[model samples]
Target: MTDSTATRATKPFRFGVVAPLTTDLPTWRDRVRRIAGSGYSTLLMPDVPKWQPAPAPTLAAAAGLADLRVGTWVYASPLRPAWSTAWEAHSLSVLTDGRFEMGIGTGRPGIEDELRELGLPVTRPGERLAQVRETVTRLRELDGPDLHTPVVMAVRGPKARALAAEFADTVTFALMPGDDRAEMTRLVRDFRTDRDVELSQHVAVVGDSVAPFMASPDTDPAALRAADSLAVLPDDPAAAAEEIQRRREEIGFSYFVFGADFAEKLAPVVAELAGH
Candidate 1:
């Protein structure tokens, strides 16, 4: 199916910045305010433990300081009990006055090692998917009837996609570097065949710089450009805007996320295309 046939083409464009707080409190507050002032719709935090502050408290702080939405650029489901995760997500939704989105997934690649390191159970893929489902289910129960917290799911395999179809308000593909653009197109088309959930693309690199935790430190921009990876975007504002429009038109990707490092540089593109 072509983009014209896809349901997400009608969705307005929006951008999100995945910025982990790596600075002092005052500096971080300034960065959050700056991102809000820019045209980005959401301020997202990574879920990696020990790398930065916890997502909940930090996200709450960001929400207090900015007018934009806040979210976990995805919570790793295997780290905590489903109820605990759900309760935290629901609290964020309430604390942010419904401006919080719960972006979650089974976990990143090789998360089992991390779980083992943390002394958490290393669950199988199916079990991890079950954990994700339970978390969403309990979150809905906690949210009650009046509040429906938005769910953004990062999916890779068929099972995860099926689960996402059942519960997600937004879905982002868990794509790796050098993955084929055509394959991603097919996935988006297939997922949107009978569903109109929002489609999000996680951009790892803008120009020559790779965002922290988004990709390997040694990631080569030249190689990504040569391979035409979707994880990278052109640095020039016009070129980036053009590529973003093309992605939305052809692959049904209307929500683009970038690392916080390039949020300022990409603000112009956000200004030109956001909510359009």
Candidate 2:
């Protein structure tokens, strides 16, 4: 089975889309079919209640649809018990034939409504990060000693970033349009560990339309380009290659994710950066 170690050793500068389940089954199936051959390395969906479909079923559907790797953009650790969350993740890992990469994090702000709905406590960052620690440990145990389930830790703080460095195969940061190279370098430095961990940047690629859905509302594609945050090119393959080089040399980001708006537009960039 492909584990975290193997993934980090082999996977190159990869690209993925966090496609939302905003449409009906037939339409979603057609979209999935298109994305399966779009040169993306992974197919991920966010676990925001009511904002997107239930993560497990949606990810399982993606697994059934194609050979592309599947995972949650991240499931909030505090939302479900470690065992239950691990059970679902474990089942998906098996179902997807080791194509599952479990991305998890402490629940974000404004999760109080969801917590209230789920009868979960709205704990502080420390307790939530502890939940993340327990969750990753349980997932590994659930996957068994022989088969390691690749894990991704999405975090931004020192303590949570520490959890990611220790337990994850990849770590994703929600960078803003105004964030400079120095800040990004600092974040990578903070997230670095002796173990291999691919650093991922979730950038909003603008083509058809900017995804209003983003970690930060300020991630508008036009605004980002204006602010010098947009590095990869969607139309020019050479420019895309240049962006890939810059990412690797400047800050060591090997994985990049975009919203569904870039699904079709990201093809050229993905084709250019898929293997290299």
Candidate 3:
């Protein structure tokens, strides 16, 4: 058997879709099929309130349709018990036959409101990250038929990134080429002792006009500073397609996760890269 470490290190180049939770299943399925047909192999469904489906049931509903791998973009670590999340993820892995990848992070902003609405307590982030670590460790210990998935950590800060390298199969971040990008990569590499751990990266793309539409002159300097190599491409679909492809290659992520609306436009771009 290939060592788990080697297997992770050697996983193939992947293209994945980030399915927003609120999208209808029929729409999502159609998208997934198109994505699979377009040569992408993975799907990253976000676990936020509006994005989350009934995990196992939703996954089951989409099961066996295409040659695609699927997993959570992230589940809110601070909101639920480590044991509960661990078991839930494990069960999903079993149901999906090892196609699941777990992305976890400290709860996001406004989580308090969401939890209260769902009748849950709102806790602090540091405590939740710690709890999540313990739960992930325990889940990693399970073997045999109960096991099939790999847990990943999505972190931005240095300390959390280091911790993820030590425990998770993959350590990922929302990276756009900037001081933070260089710093994040450096931290991950410095702390990552094993060749086995995978580094997953995220990048956002927008047409050249997007700079005007999405970014304001007063947007936080820290956020803007974080997006250094962030490109401003032409508004035309073809030009946007080319620009997205270029950005993906420049970023060097193991997977390229395209937004839903960009799927059709990104098809030729993805094909161009694959051919290379």
| Best candidate, TM-score | 1
**Which is better, 1 or 2, measured by lDDT?**
1
Tens-digit lDDT track for model 3 on 1-276? 222333343344455566554567688788778887887656666666544565545655555667667777677786678888888777777777787777788755557888888887677767767877877876776535556477778776656765676777776664433445455435434444444665554434444222211123343444443454332334465765565554434433455555556567666666656434
**TM, every model:** 0.96, 0.87, 0.74
Q: Which lDDT value does model 1 have at 135?
A: 99
Residue 67, candidate 2: Cα error in Å is 1.2
Worst 10 residues of 2 by lDDT: 1-10
Better of 2 and 3 by TM-score: 2
Can you rank all candidates by TM-score, best first?
Answer: 1, 2, 3
Q: Against the hidden true structure, what lDDT does model 1 obtain? A: 0.90
Question: Candidate 1 — worst ten consecutive residues by lDDT sum?
Answer: 1-10
Which residue ranges in model 1 land beyond 4 Å of their true spot?
Answer: 1-5
User: Against the correct fold, how does model 3 do in TM-score?
Assistant: 0.74
Candidate 2 residues 88-131, lDDT tens each? Answer: 88888888888998888876666777898877788877888888
In terms of lDDT, the best-performing candidate is: 1
Looking at candidate 3, the ten consecutive residues that score lowest on lDDT are 208-217
Indicate the residue-level lDDT of 219 in model 1: 88
lDDT of 2: 0.75
- How much is the lDDT of residue 34 in candidate 2? 79
